[model samples]
Target: MIYLNQAGYAPNSTKRATITGNNHYNLFSADGKKILSGECTLEFDENSGENAAVIDFSEVTEEGRYFFADEDNFRSPEFVISKNHYDQALRDSMKMFYFQRCGMELEEKYAGVYKRKACHCGGGYILGDRFQRRKMLGGWHDAGDYGRYVTAGAVALAHLLYGYEMFPGALTLNLNIPESGGSLPDILAECKYELDWILDMQDEDGGVHHKCTSASFCGFIMPDEDDLDMVITPVSSLATADFVAIMALASRIYHKFDEPYSNTLAAAARKSWTWLIKNPSFIFENPKEVTTGTYEDLCDADERFWAAAEMYRLDKNEDAMKVILGTMELHLSMHCLGWADVAGLGTLSIINSGTDFFGKDLYNRLVMKWLDEADRLKLISQSNAFGITLRPIEFTWGSNMVILMNAMILCVAHKLTGDDSYLKSAQYQLDYIFGRNAMDLSYVTGIGERAFKHPHLRPTAADNIDAPIPGFVSGGPNFRPCDEAANPDNMSDVPAMKRYADDVRSYSTNEITIYWNSPLVFVLGYMNSL
Candidate 1:
């Protein structure tokens, strides 16, 4: 079988595919006319423990639909080589957030066949005090569940707003959401839905709730069908700090369109900054009775650094700058742009602020650190058969997000330095998500010839639609299958790359999260802009 990007490739991009045993390959047009032929070079893939015949057809730059045929009679899925190859996928991925919106009726005009009534619209009671109800009406559902979490939502927003900031041209398309004709771009408008909810999560004291969820996970049912009581979890330093960072960033982005709302965000950010400074070590844990997702973190240093960095970027506050300088080494050492560790996001904000804010010496240092990480990821991609930056141990839960995030880092490196190598590495990572893996599966739903269909999302499972909602990214390939549904028939013993089950019961591997899709949007937005 040929493993390549089923979503296709950009015409001038490096086009490569891997076959298990075939040593020769031919690229054919839609009508079976041969366009290019190449001899495959054999490479040992450590993840799959197989010798892969790698096909490199980078010379095929014409805009047309094509496929590969191997000597062993295996024909690859048809894919397009065009400048607009990623346009549909990018739009679908962005529209995914609109589909995930809570507390609002999804009109048929916007949602089409997936349209549904408003869900979870009732005000949520404070977890410890049932009598105290707060209006928690909007925001995208955090993941496969109906929960809304601050840390996750903030990280997801960072990906999106940063994408808009860096590539405004790509994200300016009309997504046909309710805010389609608004003054702000549709991307920022869609994000404001969640931003409003995030603001509501902040208490009078400025601390933000960790999450708003039921006491436990509900059965698989439509969002409106599930009658579970929503409870607002207690505030944590992590949530507060993340809230500060994202609110600060959003304030800047929304300032041009809505100065009043932007000022509200800035005020909210400052309040949260105060809360973070006062309650510096407040880490949240799930109360004994609550059985929902915890999102508990052991340390809040990175969150504080990110919050401080954003606050600094917002107004050049000296206190925030002092915090950034104090945590500069720790921020530089951190490599991940995940929910748990967001110092990288803070670094990005600082880097984007330019050397005028931070001295030239410090700016150069940060640039060097980013380039060095990109260089390391490039080497890792070269060493692998799929040309992705995942090590064997890195194929844990939510591994697909890791792939996209690595691609995001490579994209940033490309922008920092005009080296085409970084961009190529980023494209390879996108290719892996589209197909180009041992499973021959596109990790995104409804996007490719063999996209994964069953996501662990409750609404999709209960919608009765034959296909899951489009553009929600699957977690992908967890070596340690935590659920019995994922480990059926001793499937956990398979190679890490093939350990994925398409079962909706396999939440560890098959679940889709807002943050996961956000990076996909960022990467796709960047590619489309190019």
Candidate 2:
């Protein structure tokens, strides 16, 4: 079996594949013509305990459909080599957000056969004060379940906003949503849908609610069919800080299109910032009897750091600067871009500010640290058999997010240093996502030749559609499977990378989330830009 990117590659990009045995291989066009031939080199992969034969066909730069054939008549999946190879995938990934919108009816015209009525549009009762209901609607569903979370939404929005900031030309595609043809790009318009909901999550006291969810996850049903009572949970520093960071960033991004709306976001961000200063450490816990997705974090320092950095960027606030320097002194986790550890987003904001708001020395220090982390990920990709940057221990839940997050870092590093090596490593990470892994499965729905169809998304499961909504990325391989479908009983001897089940029941390994697809959008946008 040969593993390569089933989604194809850029014409001038690095193209490689991994097979099990060493042999002379021939690259054949869609016709019977041979394009190139290469000898595969055998090397022992310590992580997978396999003798992998690696093929490098980077020199084949012609635009055409092709496949690799070995001496044993093993033919790899057909892929295309072209400059615009990733354009559709990038558009689909971004459009997935439009499909995930909560309160709006998905008309058949825009959503095709997967249309549904507006869901969760009713005003939600506050968790404690059941009689006092507030109109809490809009924003994409947090994950497979129909919950709406602030921290998750903020990080996901940050990814799209930052991606647009980096590669505006690539992300300016028309998504054909209801908000298409607006002054703002469809990307920002879609993000504004969530931003509007996020703004509602903020309280009069300036603190943002952690989430608005049912007491328990509902059954596998369409969003409108899940009739459980949705309640707004109390605020947390985590949510408030993340809300401030993303809103501040959005204020600047949307200013050119709508200054009044931008001012609203900026004011909300300042209010949240004030709340963060007063309440230094309010970690949210799932209230008793409310058992929905608890995005609980032990520390809110990174969240605060991201908030301060973004606030400082919006307006050179001296207090925000103090928090920034102070957080840097604490040496928080700066390499991770996950919702739980968002110091990297703060670092990114500071680095992208382009003005030495933190002083030239501190700015340079942050750049070097970011590049150093990217270098580490590049080396890991180089050493791995599949050219992915995953270690055995890193195959936790939502591992694909790790892969794409690393790719985002590498792409940014390439942008900063203009080094093709970083970009090449980033391509390898994307290749792993497409179909260059042990399972030979594309973790995204409706992508690649053998894409995983059954995601743990409630809408896909209950919509009665044969195929899931395309472009929803599955939470890839979790060695310590937590769902019944992928539990230890059935996956006792499976390798870490192969410990995935494409079943609706395998929520641990198969659930899809907005945040998961956000970095994918960022990475694909970068690739398309190149």
Model 2 bad stretches (over 4 Å): none
User: Who wins the lDDT comparison?
Assistant: 2
Write the residue-wise lDDT of candidate 1 on 179-256 in tens digits.
999898999999999999999999888989989988999999988886899999889999999999999999999998
> Could you estimate the TM-score for every candidate?
0.98, 0.98
**Candidate 1 residue-wise lDDT at 34:** 96
lDDT of each: 0.88, 0.89
Tell me how candidate 1 scores on lDDT: 0.88
Q: Which stretches of candidate 1 lie over 4 Å from their true place?
A: none
lDDT at 151, model 2 = 95
